[model samples]
Target chain A: MSDAAAGPLATVTLRVDAAEIDAFAETLGMPASPVPPTFPIRFLFHPEIRAALAMFLPADGSLPIHVGQRFRYHRPLTAGETLTCAVSATPPGGARPFALVRLDVSDGTGAAVCQAESEIAIAAPGFTWDKLK
Target chain B: MNPPRPGEKLAAVPIGPLDGAAIERYARASGDDNPVHLDPAAAGAIGLPDRIAHGMLVMGRLSRLALGWRSDAVLEAFECRFTRPVPAGAALTGDGRVAKVDALADGHRVILRLLARDADGAIAAMGEATLRLPG
Candidate 1:
């Protein structure tokens, strides 16, 4: 994809290994469910995924977030579950670039494990109030 | 007011200098194939020098800190807003405090206020979580 204004958007994918999932379940002290454990466990095993997304997306340097932006997650993973997470921007009202993301977890046999969606926004690095005005 | 839970305090948790393979591994796990995360050139187009981490991935880190305090507590709700970007190969630290703890007749629950930071001490993400603890 080119850096041009019209270049194709970027999307990142991350995988959750089974071994790591088990370790996470063990850490949380819950019997491994047919799904992957939520939150903290997702962090340790799939941190690289987080790093990759942050490299490009912009953020608020301080506190107080924008109204349209949010985050979300799904439940546990059964052994051998493959999750596909994606983040991108959409045209809100066909003008402003609105951040949107989704996660799709599934096993090879055509059954989905978990799915979620949330909004995102890319603030220009060193975002300035003047730019917004 | 009643006394706070045994070991409740706003604190920090440490994380890491993530490698490329790990990033790739997470991408596969989440089923996302965005080039910016997998391709350096794509990231550059977005004003990023190289591939970066996922926001949800950062939230996951924050979640770990929130849940780390108890052995059998189940997360009832996990929510946050990504405040900043966390670059690849950067060290991460997570923090949280007990916002509220309610003891019900059946069991007890706690609301944890959370924050995850990058090596630079930047608040990469912030949020709150509700966990259910049985007696």
Candidate 2:
């Protein structure tokens, strides 16, 4: 995808790997479920996507900080399905000076796999601002 | 807070001490290599005392609690915000409780309150989740 006027937009496709799913559960010390609810995050914000995010950072050298996240699912994504993710990074909102990165993951068949919204702090290192507790 | 019941405490998630190695493992596992979660120098440059665990890493603990609920229940939604920076290497505790339950067209909608705290007792992350259970 080309760069949008507002920010950078990138897309990538990946297959749902069962090993990856079980690893996520094992890492968290939980028994893997028949379906993973939040596994899409790994692929949606995978390393390359993170690089895409860095490109949109403020020219002042401020790095992005993840402040919050929300996940919605039509149904749990299972194995045997390939996913395509469209990630768009938007400049910080007016009231809050934080970037809102939206990621929409869909099955190859165009079905919604999961929708995730990430709130990132776009402040550069050493920048001063009221910190939230 | 008068008394607690056995059936009430559904899950006890043991968030192992989040250290650099562990954080790196999580970064590798979650595919989130945000420098802040892996580099203490970078985290310090940003005013954080040290490298901090990803908010999702802390939030994921709630899944254990969600799963401990009725087997028929399906986790429909989960939402939360980062309240404070949970420095890597701190022992974290996760607790979940049923806040409310309502009837839905397909099943019962169960709302569960989720909270994770550092060893110091400060809330690291908190949120609510909805589960649809066929009755």
Candidate 3:
């Protein structure tokens, strides 16, 4: 994947709801006092973000495999904060077809709070990088 | 508490013989309603034998382990690479070892090498984490 091909694929806004955080923590069997480090992943499921991701998914309804992830926390996230999450993807490369996805999250004031990177494999049977490109 | 020495193995934390119900709860809570994790039929359509667990769920479990390592420790970064899929009813265990420790002005910067393995002893995921432990 060339640097030029790596550009913002989608941007979505999410409000950090304490209730949702609680639910997420509860589901994972963790304490809810502090937001879980991986909670930002929920932003990927935002309707707009999902729409953007659909562009790379297979028409046959096969979901991409999440092969890797990385999270960097700038500071602790607080409840009641509005966050802007920007997602970008590199063109699929490597022996297996996989794309590197990056998510940049900032608070309403635009200060960076966290960043996440994920590697997703789209190499299910009959799927090819050409289809995504 | 004393700072962890390099190469010290952290205790293993058992996660699950995960079932569909747990996966569904995660989907509901995280808003990830991917059919591949929810519907076996959808998973089978794509060649998966059964519904699979969310990779993020495994990461969350590992994060919990890291956080609980020390009350004064704060997580700064976490990274993981999924090596294999965790099918429904498969259990997982997470463990880590202190890889490096550097004394900082306020505390220690600790690097941990982490792994999650399936019941069959196959590595399901492996990664590293960075945490700041107060002196």
Candidate 4:
């Protein structure tokens, strides 16, 4: 993962692996052809993106709870296609201490493929915005 | 197929009694190896009663139910809010209703309000989807 310019926190290249899609399809008991609408969310959990998210997590063992998700597909993603994914996150805030993470995926030709956003609730006592960089 | 009228209910899809192995498969497939969804011990340490299913996995099943409503329609957007965590061994059923429909030059744009209910009929998650049906 490399540092991205102003908007995105980091960027990484992702391939739409057929095997992974098959596994996902089997798990959901769906056909693998059209690529499930929520399939692109897997991109958000890429190791690189996880590493980037680690910074916002509290030192405590408290796990972040996934509270919300949204996906907008510009076109159906196909297996074996390589794409670029850029991820960005908001600082943990609000009375509940939550963060919004956004992911933008683009095809090899720089065309938009999909965009996903997830909301995670961080449950750390006494946590404040000042604690984050 | 005829366009569905507002307030029409779509067929419900029943999902698992999501056992550990099923959650593990989804963990591997999605690369979301978060211990909270995999290891019971890890989940316990974090104050959870047991390992929970991945929220995305639940959303995937709900999206499948919505997609099945119209074969010719393409899902343009989907948004879900995980109101409750689905513990291991929980069974869920996805349901949706046509919220609105708009006629475009080519086809109709449909909006669907969705929900995932636990075995007891408690809401685990709620969502909305927009699909484009070509003429």
lDDT string for model 2 (B16-119, tens) is: 67777777877887888878888888888878888888888777766667766677777778877778888888888888787886776766677888788888
- Model 2, position A79, has a per-residue lDDT of 76
Candidate 1: TM-score, chain B only: 0.83
The reply for model 2, stretches above 4 Å from the true place, is A1-8, A59-61, A127-130, B1-9
| Counted clashes in each candidate structure | 46, 2, 0, 0
lDDT of 3 by residue, B21-99 (tens): 8899899999888777888887777667888999888888878778888888888999988877789888899999999
Cα-lDDT of candidate 2: 0.73
Q: What TM-score goes with each of the models?
A: 0.58, 0.87, 0.91, 0.91
> For model 4, how does the per-residue alpha-carbon lDDT over B1-135 read when each residue is reduced to its tens digit?
877799999899987868898899999898888778988887777566888998888998888878899888889999998887789999999999999999999999999999999989988889999999998
TM-score of the candidate numbered 4? 0.91
* lDDT tens readout by residue for model 3, A1-133: 3324668988888899999999999878898878999998888888898787777765655577778889999998888989999998886765646778889999888899999988887645554423322
Cα misplacement distance, residue A28 of candidate 3 (Å): 0.8
Error of 2 at B13 (Å): 2.4
Candidate 2, position A64, lDDT? 63
What is the DockQ for all candidates, taken in turn?
0.12, 0.60, 0.54, 0.48
What does the lDDT read for residue A55 in candidate 2? 71
State the DockQ, from 0 to 1, for candidate 4.
0.48
Order of quality (DockQ): 2, 3, 4, 1
Q: What is the lDDT of residue A129 in candidate 3?
A: 29
Which candidate, 1 or 2, would have the higher lDDT against the true structure? 2
- Place model 1 in a CAPRI quality band: incorrect
Total clashes in model 4, counting residue pairs 3 or more apart in sequence or in different chains: 0
